[model samples]
Target: MTEQQYNECVNLYSDNVYRFIVKNLRHQEDARDIVQSAFEKMWRHRESVEFDKSKSYLFTVAYNQMIDHLRKVKRINLQEDFTETTKGVQHQQTPQVKKALMEALNRLNETQRSLVMLKDYEGYNYEEIGRITGLNESQVKVYLHRARIALRNYLVSPENVI
Candidate 1:
């Protein structure tokens, strides 16, 4: 990738990459750092990366960085804590349905949450998601399906409805 190509990538994919990281970490500053780090890593390896594949490369790097950050922070979200957090959100003016959806999303493990975000929010195909997530295509399909089912169950549970 030339300087021009790198600049174009920064313009085109930065928001997408940032959104992915933010969804995973829920910390804007940490998300920004991870996105910046991914771009820097891409710049360092520009000679080897094809311009066409830059987006995937950026996402892959950002995902790995997020995992490392989560491990380092030991920021495990217990079920009770997650529920309490969502209850706080629910008490605010945010729609009850949206609050429920977010609570369900929070309940997911990191891999499952990433799969849903990449597929549903980012609109990446199964193969592309596999590459970004380090999963096989079949594994991506199975896991995403399960995540969707879990989300649906959470949304439909009577106790969750306002």
Candidate 2:
């Protein structure tokens, strides 16, 4: 990744990376910091990064950073707490919906969450996700299927959605 490549990567994937981080971390400010730090790390490692591999590298760095943050924070940091931390928090009667969704997502293991996010949220193809996560295409597909089923079951539970 030359300086030019780094710029292009930022222009192309910054928002996607930011969204992924924010969704996982549930904190925009922390997400922002993580993104900036990821980009900075990428910039430093530019010489080793190939353009075609940049997106995977960016996501890997951001994902690792999020994991480290979660480990270091050492707190549950529930959805209500995250909403309160928002700068322009809105009072919504749908807290139950958000809570249910969060619970469903949390029920997934970290790899499942990442695979689901990459496939469903980010719209990455299974091959792409395989390359990013170091899983084979079949493994990616199988895990994604299982994750989706689990999420559907959790979300459609009577106590959750109702």
Candidate 3:
């Protein structure tokens, strides 16, 4: 990618990459660091990444960084714990239903949650999602199906809702 293309890619996908990381990491500061590192890696490898596929490239890098960060930390951090680490957290402002849905999402494993975000939130198709998560198309489909079902079951429980 040219410098101009890289600049455009940063403008277009920074928020997307950041959002994806934050949703998975649930820690805005860590998410920000991961997002920055992802962009830095992309910047370093700009010669190899194509402008047309920059979105996927950026997301893939961010996802990988998030995985590494999680592995290094050795536990999935929850939003409640994350809030204790910093002020002005936005978890207080979300609607009840969205909060419930997010809690349901939290019940899923990493792959499942990432699949849901890549496919549902970011509008990535199966092939693209597979490429990003290093899963085959069939695996992506099966995991995503299971994730949606899990979300449904969680939401169906009266105790889980507002």
Candidate 4:
């Protein structure tokens, strides 16, 4: 890729990739670092990257890096239990509602989250999502359907409503 193409790739994908990482990780600093790492890897490989396939390449790199980050952070934590306990403090929307949404998201496997985000958040079509995530179009559709159903169930549950 030329310098021009590299700049275009960054402009086109940075926000979408950042949002995806932030939504999953729920940490702005971590999301920014992962996005930077993904783009850096993409930049390093630009010569080999097809211009038409840049979005997919960026997302794939980001997804892999996110997995690695999660793996590295895996550990027992007493503070996390305290955090969970304090999460019940009352609020307008109620922590339970937010928790249910997060729990619903967590219920999805990694691939399902990718597909749902690509479709629902990024507004990518199934073919585009399939390309980005290395799945087939049909697989993307199926995973998206399942993810939506799971989220809907959580959101519409009687306890979740005010």
RMSD of each: 4.7, 3.8, 3.2, 5.7
Candidate 3, residue 21: Cα displacement in angstroms equals 0.5
Candidate 3: residue 159 lDDT (0-100): 94
Scored by Cα lDDT, where does model 2 land?
0.81
Clashes of each: 0, 0, 0, 0
**Candidate 2: regions farther than 4 A off:** 76-103, 134-139
Q: What's each prediction's TM-score?
A: 0.87, 0.75, 0.89, 0.74
- Give the best candidate by TM-score: 3
lDDT of 3 by residue, 38-151 (tens): 889999999999899899988888898888888898778455543343343344545677668778888899989999999888899999999998899999999999999999
Model 2 lDDT at residue 50: 93
Each candidate: what lDDT? 0.86, 0.81, 0.85, 0.75
Error of 2 at 101 (Å): 3.7
TM-score of 4: 0.74
In the range 1-162, model 4's lDDT, one tens digit per residue, is 888998998999898788787666656677789999999998899999988889888888897787788779862121222123334344465566667766677667766766776787678888877776778988888888988988888778887664
Candidate with maximal lDDT: 1
Per-residue lDDT tens digits of candidate 1, residues 66-161?
999999988856323333323322334456666677789998999999999999888999999999889999999999999999998988888997
Query: Model 3, residue 49: what's the lDDT?
Result: 91
Cα miss at 160, model 3 (Å)? 3.0
